[model samples]
Target: MVLIDRIRLCLEKLLEVFTVFLLIALTTIVLAAVGFRLLGASLHWYDEVASIGLGWLTFYGANLAAIKRAHMGFPGLVGSAPVALRASLFVISEIIVIGFFVVIAYYGYLVLDILAWDRLVSLPSISLTVTQSAIPISAVLFILCELLSMPGAWAKMRHGIDSEHEAIEEAIRMAEQDLQESRS
Candidate 1:
């Protein structure tokens, strides 16, 4: 379990770093395209390349957001719910997300299959399938991150020890302890 957790953390960190780099690349591509237009030269494929990069950025960014709990959700209602109800809601929500991703992965596979039969006219550098492949890949990774977060969130709700909240509480506790010790 520890090894799996460590591996997941490492993969998450690596993906985060890679997503940052992809964002940088996407920005560079867009800037280059704009510069070419100013010079009366058209970057014929720059837009396509940048679009693919943007797709990758958005997909992996979603995964990173899931890991960080940065994705926007309607947590206000859940937050106000009673303890038992909140736990039940959290578990149900996670299950629903998992099921949704499974369906997404399946549909993504079908789309890839359909795209594989067609040839891209303008951007011949890569196949349509390659571009479409990011869907299933991202969906799978998102599911994995959500699965990992499930246990931690479940444990936290059970004990009311959310790590982010607990960190703040611990900082305050330590500060208070320090003050008491100094006065003594």
Candidate 2:
């Protein structure tokens, strides 16, 4: 368990760094492209490169969001539910999430297999698989994050405690109280 946690921490840090790098790279490419275009020296490959970078950013960003439990969702219903029911619902929701990612990743692998020989339209040097691989790669990363978080989720569910959600809720409650006090 210690080793698994160490690995998870390492993976999280690595992904965080890579995500930042991708964001920086994407921003640089985009800004440079825009500047070049303004100077009347447009780069033909800008759109293609930008689109691919955006796709990668979306995937990795989403993976990070999941890891952080920052993905948007209406959790009010679950939050209001009875403890046992909430835990059950959480488990069910997790199952659905995991199953969906697994299926998509499997199909993504198939897509990669088919597109292995294909190259990008603008960047002929790069294989389509390389660009399109963001899908399966992100899916796998998400799965790993999910699995790593399972114990915490289960403990929270069983104990009727979730520090992450509770912290947010506490903050909101405090803000509401402050607003009320100020109005009074």
Candidate 3:
């Protein structure tokens, strides 16, 4: 359990750093393209590349949100249920989420296969498959985060902890402890 926690923490930190850098690069790319256009110049690759980067950012951000359990969900019904019912509902919900990702990853590969020989319209040098690979990759990353989160949920359920509030507070406390340690 501790090992899984560490792995999840490590992935979260890495994703945070990656997201920051990705955003910086995206901003620079867009601003540079805009500035050049103001000077009667244009970057032909700007549209396609920026669009690709945005897609990647969105997918990666989804995975990050999943790990944090920050996505919008209406769990009011589950919250009012008995402990066993709540656990069962939670597990069923998780299985559904997992199933969704699995389907995405599976069909995403088939889509990639069909586009393997196709190139981007604006960037002939780049393959369509390369840009579209974000779907499957994001699916895999989301699956990993979900898998890591489940055991903790199981533990919390076993301990009769309030899933909505207590786990969130526990996560925040751990983050603060990590932050304090880094500062010290």
Top candidate on TM-score is 2
Please give the CA lDDT of all the candidate structures.
0.82, 0.85, 0.85
Compared with the true structure, the alpha-carbon lDDT of candidate 1 equals 0.82
Count steric clashes of candidate 1.
Answer: 0
User: In candidate 3, where is summed lDDT lowest over 10 consecutive residues?
Assistant: 154-163
Question: Candidate 3 at residue 152, lDDT?
Answer: 71
RMSD of 1: 4.9
User: Clash number for every model?
Assistant: 0, 0, 0
Those runs of model 3 whose alpha carbons end farther than 4 Å from true positions after fitting are 157-184
Using all chains and alpha carbons, the TM-scores for the candidates as numbered come to 0.82, 0.84, 0.83
Clashes of 2: 0
Tens-place lDDT digits, model 2, residues 1-184 = 7877787778778878989999999999999999999999998899999999999999998887777666765466666678878888988889999999999899999999999999988879999999999999999989988888667666666776655578789999999999999999
**RMSD of each candidate relative to the true structure:** 4.9, 4.4, 4.2
Q: 167, model 2: CA deviation in Å?
A: 4.0
State, as a TM-score between 0 and 1, how close model 2 is to the true structure: 0.84
